[model samples]
Target: MIIFGTSSSTIHPAKLDGGCCPFCKTKNQMWIQGYRKYFHVFWIPFFPLWKKIYSVCSHCKGVFEKKEFKDQELTTSFEYFENNKIKIPWYHFTGIILVLLLIMLISILPFLTK
Candidate 1:
């Protein structure tokens, strides 16, 4: 995410002291994994809109919007493995190809039928 404008600062869980929860202030704090700030853009039929926002405290297994709390902090994490890998199923590609073929067929059906 892009952090624009002034007063934009990123804080991490490690940097935070043993303080109360920014949300509940109940001292139930957890580690923050990653954080980012950006504008969430939405396209409307006649207008384009955007909301400047921040995402924080994702590592605690809880998602919170920046507006939900005060004194927002940013965090990040990195994990590496020797044999880590990600796989994409063949059926997923096949499904996409099938959808494209169907759309093409529909678009040309009128011409073919004539």
Candidate 2:
């Protein structure tokens, strides 16, 4: 049986403002959102299979992808999070680290027999 490895979803708050909902025409109700889909083992993400950017309408509950945003500001604002806060973490390498430790232990085992 597979003891590890899974997929996870995360949502991040965006640092954007001054956007209106195109559907409800409500001002200051739109917000930028970041999404990621990644593979993980031992609860640590290995790598993100896909990344997505979106703008959601708070009042209308509308979801808009990058190209779906009708407002130019919303499209441009999505670029702000590209390298800011949405980057993958280095701790996602826990699985790799475990493998390396096992390799090192095997390599040193012969020396311990001396």
TM-score of each predicted structure versus truth: 0.23, 0.69
- Please give, for residues 33-97, the per-residue lDDT of candidate 2 as tens digits: 76667777657666666767677788888887766667676656666655565776555556677
Q: Which candidate leads the pack in TM-score?
A: 2
Off by over 4 Å in 1: 1-86
Off by over 4 Å in 2: 3-5, 42-44, 104-114
lDDT of 1 by residue, 1-114 (tens): 543232212333332323334555444353433322222222111111232233333234444543444443322211111012212223324434566788999999999999
Q: Score each candidate by Cα lDDT.
A: 0.36, 0.69
Clashing pairs in 2: none
- Worst-scoring 10-residue span by lDDT in model 1: 77-86
